[model samples]
Target: MSLRRGAAHGAAWNFATAVGERSIGFAVLAILVRHITLADVGLIAIASALSEIGRMITTGGSGEQVVASPGDRTVEAGAFWAQFILAAAIAGLLFVAAPVLARAYGAPALSWVTRVLSVNIILGTFLVVPSARLVQNFGFRALSLMSLGSTILGGTVALALVFSGRGLDALIAQRIVGITFYAAAASITARWYPPAFPSLAAIGRALRFNIPMMGAAFVDYVAATGYVVLIGIRMPVAAVGEFRIAQRLAEVLRELTVFPASKVFLPVFVAVRDDPDRRFAVARSLVDVLAIGSLAAAAVAGAVAKPVVVLMFGVRWASSAPVFAALSLIVPAAAVYAFVNPMLTALRRPVLVSVFAAINAASTALAAWFAAPEGLLILAWTLAARGLLTAILLLPALSIGIGRPAWPLLRLFTAPFIALIAARVAAAALVPVLVQQSGLGIVAMFSQLAVGGIIAASVFLGTLALLAPRRIGTLLGQLTSAFRRVPVVAEPVG
Candidate 1:
């Protein structure tokens, strides 16, 4: 299959997977929130935050290597065993340290929660190579189906457990079941098995490539979840829960937009790594689409956060609304920022990626610390500010990687930023009127969100169309044409 066609198929499947999984996951969360208390939610958040380090270590850079070098059975075998060992080690470490982490957070429940969730690291080890093989072969359809099925089944189980009042244990069970299903499905779909042993040389090479990537991933993990840890330490557990929910909602927007794009585009970029002009063009198009889509989603999500939170989690979670709103501003910045790792990795610049990750980690830690005392809202705002700064920090590197000036790359953000501003204005003017007209029930909240979202979206899109008619037209035409083409499945790149 042609690269364009392959990309289209991959993107389509990734989008489907993201939409399906997130939808089911969100439903499960909404239900769980009704059953779980603020402290229960907060405890889970702390557990997740602590487990993220292990998760990062287990699956970090290994999959990228597999995807990038699919022909190397030796490397794949090496990565498989290496990751399995690492995952087991990390799980053990987490088990041993759970008490310490629990003590640090002053939440005794966190010890067991972290220990239970730690098992997922071992499951994640089984996932890395199979998933990479699927992506390498452009087997997105199978991957998407597996993801959707696993999410639905696990979500069902989670809902049942939550209804039975399992609380944090329910969340832990949901994660384990979902990942176990995905790993099993991926292994079956890939039709590959690990060898008895991997060559030392192959393991060395894999480790060399993966270790820095792991470093970057580890620091990036810290950057992403450090605030939650700090909040758990310095603030109340309920505050951590609120921040976590807000982050989750904002991340759902991202998962639906930028996350899938990142997954799709990374392999695509790696495939075309040798073709500079093509790579740059593809990167530019991706940036344009993500910028517009994520900003639009963020704007609408920010505007409707209050009503949505109230409706989804009831009035008790209403406190998370402003945090969600604050984090929404980071969406566009994150969209732009997503390209950095993929593009640099494609160029075989792990060192540069690591540097960027370090910078981001330091900045995020500092920002979170500075804002921790102020409250969740301020911490969230700081997160948004740090996102923008991270994006700015990445521009010079992106310009260097893509062979484009920083100015044009910066210009790509202008339309979306302007459109977001307009959307916010429209929402501000429309929301109060809708609230007054509809009163304050669930139905009213839904009506207000629906109407307000539509108006805001229309304004944003209309403004963008006016500002960049030609670009929008070209993008639409490309998308339409891509959709019409017959998908061609290809063998994994060797």
Candidate 2:
């Protein structure tokens, strides 16, 4: 129908997809954890992380080229095939290398697991074009539903496999099956097919756009993976297991809350590519929503970090509560960087974005070197530095391009910090009271949740309402309008 309608549908689908996918992953993980040791889990983490890094590197800049290139259905489909072939070839190599990589990491047991999980990379190549199309065209509704269906199917299969006592193999199988089904569903839903004559010329053109984007991607990979690498090198495998779980939980919250909005904003940038004023307005609104929502989640995470970890993963994971709390601070800070990155891309500022990313990468490495001795605390310092550096680097671009924020963007920091402090106080007060109870205490569970929820809600909402009423009103109106829009696609995918 309209751009807004497409965005609304896309947002709805993204949220549904996230919930479904993450639920399946969590379920599969919990079941697998029963049979596998922490060291096994650590290997799984390394494998998955490596797989992601592989995909990012091989595909490189195709994601940006999808937007930058102007092409008809034939050219687009051909380009998609070429990229898919490239990605599949790369994934195949990694699949074979999985064993070698595992041996190097001193976790040879992970070899098969890595190989099985590598199938996802191949499947991802096929889906990327359609996924980008759905997002580029604001077809979130279809995207989300396909994702949900894939997740449910994947989850059911994994649960059945777990029940059959296949252990980590089942988890690996779950990923392959889920990604395959997800891509098939996405292709059907988006009504896209690869053209027969895949173009070398198109590939070359796309590479011109994507190579720089690849550099940016590499920086991100290094920044993110550095933690996993550092943790594996410096800490016990069991400690890595704890940090991984904590990172997973924090990431789940982030993907659901932040990523959906970022996806919607990308198309917004595309639509208003030439109008700096409108682009800035859209960017500001997106940032405000992200900042406020992220703060609220971080507050709850900080407040209930102890109980949440204990309830979800068991007392063995109690240490993750603080680790998670440290990582939670990075979410809102990362949101600002996330918001601006897409805006820069839409405005043909990928090089500038790369520069900021490089700075983040260097800072992350330095932070890791210093804090590596302390486990999660090192990660915390790294994230804190990232948030600061991201904001500083973006300021010149923001001031010169996007209008100055209604409030200093840094002012958004107050709510999360305040919420974190308040939540920690609440946690310190309530944790001792509830955690002392006997086996399987629902009283403790609900009380911790209730107290945490109230404190987090009060602090996050009160701070935002008082500090930025205009931004709040704009967000409420946007959400309301988004709900009212129909979910039909107005433009052709081809």
- Which candidate achieves the best TM-score against the true structure? 1
**Backbone clash numbers for all candidates listed:** 0, 5
Scored by CA lDDT, what does every candidate get?
0.81, 0.67
lDDT per residue for candidate 1 within 289-308, as digits (tens), equals: 78788888988888788888
Q: Quote the positional error of residue 174 for candidate 1 in Å.
A: 0.6
Give the local distance difference test score of model 1.
0.81
Best by lDDT: 1
lDDT at 322, model 1: 87
Per residue, candidate 2 scores C-alpha lDDT tens digits across 1-494 of: 66666666666677777877777767666666666667766777777777776666655556555655444564465456656776788778988887777667677776777777766766777777767766666667777777777777777787787778766666666667778887888888767666576567766766656666767776777665535755566666666776788778878878877887777766677787787766655665566667777777877777777667777766666777777767776676567667655766777777776777777667766676677567575666566656666666656655544645534555555555565566556656765565555443557766676677676677666666665556666667676676675432222100
